[model samples]
Target: MTCIADANVLFSLLVEGHVAHEVARGWWDEQPDGAVGTCLLTRLAVLRLLTNRVAMNGTPVTPTEALGAWGRLGNDPRSVHVEAEPAIHESRFISLVSGRESTPNLWTDAWLAALAMSLDYEITTFDRGFKSFRGLRLRLLSMADK
Candidate 1:
C-alpha cells in the first residue's frame, strides 16, 4: 500500500538506537519502490527531534549529521517525496483544525491527516492520536519500548 510516515515513524527510522527502530525498519524495508512516502513537514520534524539535546538523551546529532541521515533515506528507491495539492488539501486541512481549540501540535497532525486522506494514502505511525481523525487510514505500529 502507498503509505506516508508520521514524524515519529520517520524519527525512529532515522535513529538506529530508537526503541521502535527495529520494527520501524522491518516495516520500512518491506515497502515496494515508491511505496513509502515523506513530506517536508514530517521530514523537518524528524530532523528537529534528531538534533534536540534533551530529546536525544544529551547526544544530539549536529544539523549536518541529521541531514546526512535524511539524505541517505531519501536516496532509497523505496522512499518517495510527496506534496499535498494545496487546492484539494487546503479545505480538508481547514475542516480538520476547525471547531476545536487545538493544541499547537494538533495543527500538524491535522495537516498530515488531511494530506493522507486527500491523497488516498495511509499514514504509518505509532501515534494512536491519528485515530481521532475520521476517514483517515492508519497503519498504527506498536512501539518497541512500550
Candidate 2:
C-alpha cells in the first residue's frame, strides 16, 4: 500500500530525530515494496525549514548534510514514491473538506489530503486537524495525543 506523508512527519525525522522518525520508518517498511510516497510540498517544507535554520544560525547547512537524512530514508529498499507535482487544485479540496464554509490555510496539508483522496492513499500524520476531514485514511503517530 502507498502512504502519503505530511511535512511534520518528514521534519520530525530530519530535525527532531527518533520517536516519530522511527515510527514513520517502521510504517513505511511495513508497506509493500515501493509504496511510500511524498508530495513536492513536503520536500519544499523540509528545505524551507533547513534554510530557516541556517539563516537563524548565520551559517548554511550544506546540501549534503541537509539531504543526508532524506537520502537515507528515501533509499530504503522498501517501495517509496515521491510526488513531484508543484500545485494542486485548492478550491476543489476546500469545497470537499469544508463545503461552503471558508477553510483556513490552503497549503500542503489540504493539497496532500486532496492528492491522497484522489489516489486512494493513506495519510501518515500526527496532526489532529486531519481528523476533521472525511474519507481520508489516517495513520497518526502514536505519540500524537500524548
Candidate 3:
C-alpha cells in the first residue's frame, strides 16, 4: 500500500527520543520499498518542528541535523515524493474549511489531507483531526506515549 507519512509520524521516526519513536519507526521500517511516500508540505512541517526550539520543548535540533534527517528520507529509494499541487490542494482545502471557523492550524491539517487525497495516498499519523476530513484515507497509528 502507498502510505503518506504525516509530519507527526515522520518527526517521530526521525527524532530518536520522540514519544512515538519506536512505534513510528517500526511501522515505517515495515513498509516495502516505495510504499512510503510524502509531499513537500509534510517535509517542511517536519523540518519546522525539528528546528523550532519552543515547539520542540526548547530542545530543537540544529539546522544541519534537520536537513540531514530530511535528506535521509528523501534519499530513500523506497519512498515517493509527491508534487506540491496547489490547485487541487486549494480546492479540497476550501471545501474542507467552508462554513466552518478554522484556525491556521486547521488549515494546515486541511492542506495535508488535501495533498494525500489528491495523490490517492493513505495518510499515516496519530492525529485525530484527520478524522474530520471525510476525503482522507488514514492509517491511524496509536502513539507510543498514549
The model with the greatest TM-score is 1
TM-score of each: 0.93, 0.70, 0.88
lDDT for each residue of candidate 2 in 1-146, tens digit (9 for 90 to 100): 67887777766666544356676655554677666677667777766666565432555466676687567767866536564433454554765556434456444566787878777788888787777667888878766433
Rank order (by lDDT, best first):
1, 3, 2
Which wins on lDDT, candidate 1 or candidate 2?
Answer: 1
lDDT by residue for model 1 over 25-52, one digit each (tens)? 8888778999988999988999999999
Q: Rank the candidates by TM-score, best first.
A: 1, 3, 2
TM-score of 2: 0.70
Q: lDDT by residue for model 3 over 72-133, one digit each (tens)? A: 98888767887666567778878887887766578878877887787788989888888989
Off by over 4 Å in 2: 16-19, 54-60, 82-94, 97-106, 144-146
Residue 27 of model 1 has an lDDT of 88
The clash count of every prediction, one per candidate, is: 0, 5, 1
**In model 3, which regions exceed 4 Å deviation?**
144-146
Residue 92 error, candidate 3, Å:
1.9
